[model samples]
Target: MQLFGGRKQDEALAKREEQVRKLETECRTLQTSLEDTRELVRHLDQDRELLLGALEHLRPGMDVQPQAQVLLDVCFKPLGLACFYVALADWDQDLLRFVLYHEGGRFRNHPSRRLSDRSGLSERVLAGRRPVYIRTLEEGRAAGSLLTAAEQATGLIPHSWYGVPLGRGSRPSGLVSFQSFQTDAFSEGRRRVMDALTGLLSICMDGPPTPQGR
Candidate 1:
């Protein structure tokens, strides 16, 4: 009877040891997976930084066209932007002339084109004084009346858009709008970074000297 009891105790100890070994193996596997996830996140964050947060690289006195090009190159192209437009308000407020426009695979300088009216999207965006990052263009049109028929028909219609006012506060001096042919092209993370970059863009409209470059 004494020998049988000793054997039972030994077997129990061996069973516990085996269980511990299995648990250790699972813990190691989980740790490896966690490390890999962290590394992937780190790379994504770096890409995000370069995509929108690097607007300061445009530098003061950078030509406005060059600045705009750099913005497209870094911000829109990497994220699959199809087109963009930049316009400044005339003192009369009767018109928002296109200062820089790119669409359907080309960029043009349309300093004379009258773009928006008092009730149009550009004016409304400035009046609303907030960035509108629409995940889908259909949703934007359905949500409210913004773009005019001419605005909608005159160019490459967008699938989605993210636009920001180019002035301080609700009374913006102008605006820069980016659009894409792909839905959900812009994300909240990009909007946050672009929001911070507005001041820099405003400065460039005059500081970078677009007029002299022409």
Candidate 2:
């Protein structure tokens, strides 16, 4: 009986130890899950702050040009790309006349130049009623004779490019184009930024034009 009692006590102790180990594992798993939840909350808070800032910038009565400049400056400067706002006169004309160009660094502004009337890409984009992404300058040059001439005249060598059409319904008002000297510089992230900027520009375009005197 004494031997049996000792054996029973040892068994109880072993079972107690097994229970403690299982409890410890469960506690560690809970701790890890809590940490993951905290990290997710922190990321959500950062995203909320970012979205709020963008909303504030998009408030009504803002100057369109300055707004566009701010968008390009903040969005593309880090990526090292040039941004341009082209205001078109007529959708049927198949032209994108330059309204403004925001250089990445200290580069001087190249004066506004007329688009080549024969540019099919420009016309197709305007008439197609959708945003057009020109991935390469070579594609543009090959599609239209005028593109090559324009490149030579301005010395604007674009290895990669993306453009968005700006207009409501049938009246295509303009286009916004981003360019980079490096090939395939516009990644998926950069493309999303451009989309947001273009959305803001589209809203601004619908409003009344600012007075020349102002």
Candidate 3:
């Protein structure tokens, strides 16, 4: 009888241990879900602020410089972008000229490169007249050559990047790109927001022949 009692107690203890392990697993899953919910809420707030700022600051009649600055301000922190660039297709010279190349809290001078250059992802977007999104630089490199020697030299290479063609012509007139240092930073929702933002940008970018070296 004592042996049987001992066996039953051991069985009960094992069952309790199993229940405790299951509960711990459930708690971890709940914690992760809560964190994801918080992140989504943060992104929604940022999107709201970005759209409000765009409405107030971005106007179709604005010049390239002012509009570009407004765009950078509204987008940089809200979208958590590490770099943003606006490169127009100069088909006449077969070049892609960057009007705005912003990074590290300021703009940088970007040299014009031939449209045929595989390194400039902007050219690929223009050529395809579509969007290109890479979750990592390794993915981009695997798809094709990722960056030019000059761009690589900057030492600010992004972990994730996305770009969309601008304008409705047979070939896009330009491209607007956003870069992030964190993998999977730009979700489908964020990409959709960027698409809307680019529409406003296209309106602002319209009107003038983008002069060389802007």
Q: Which predicted model would earn the best lDDT?
A: 3
Instruction: For candidate 1, write residues 56-171 as lDDT tens digits.
Output: 46666776667766666666655566777776776464677766788766876554434344545566666677777777767767645355344567844676777788877645
lDDT of 3 at 117: 69
Q: Write the per-residue lDDT of candidate 2 for residues 54-109, one digit (tens) a residue.
A: 55665445655666665555555455675454445443553455555654343334
Query: Across residues 1-214, which tens digit of lDDT does each residue of candidate 3 receive?
Result: 9999999999999999999999999999999999999998988988888888887888776766677778888998878898888888878778888888887667888788888765656777887888889898788677664564446777767778899888877768788899998987898999988887887788777854667995
Task: List per-prediction Cα lDDT, in the order shown.
Answer: 0.69, 0.62, 0.82
- What lDDT would candidate 3 get against the real structure? 0.82
Please identify model 2 stretches exceeding 4 Å from their true place: 1-54, 90-97, 103-123, 145-156, 208-214
TM-score of each: 0.64, 0.56, 0.76
The candidate with the higher lDDT, 1 or 2, is 1
- Per-candidate count of clashing residue pairs (backbone under 3 Å): 0, 0, 0
User: What ranking of all candidate models by lDDT puts the best one first?
Assistant: 3, 1, 2
lDDT: which is higher, 1 or 3? 3
Task: Return the clash pairs for model 2, or none.
Answer: none
- Which RMSD values do the candidates have, in order? 6.7, 8.3, 6.1
Off by over 4 Å in 3: 90-95, 113-119, 138-154, 182-185, 206-214
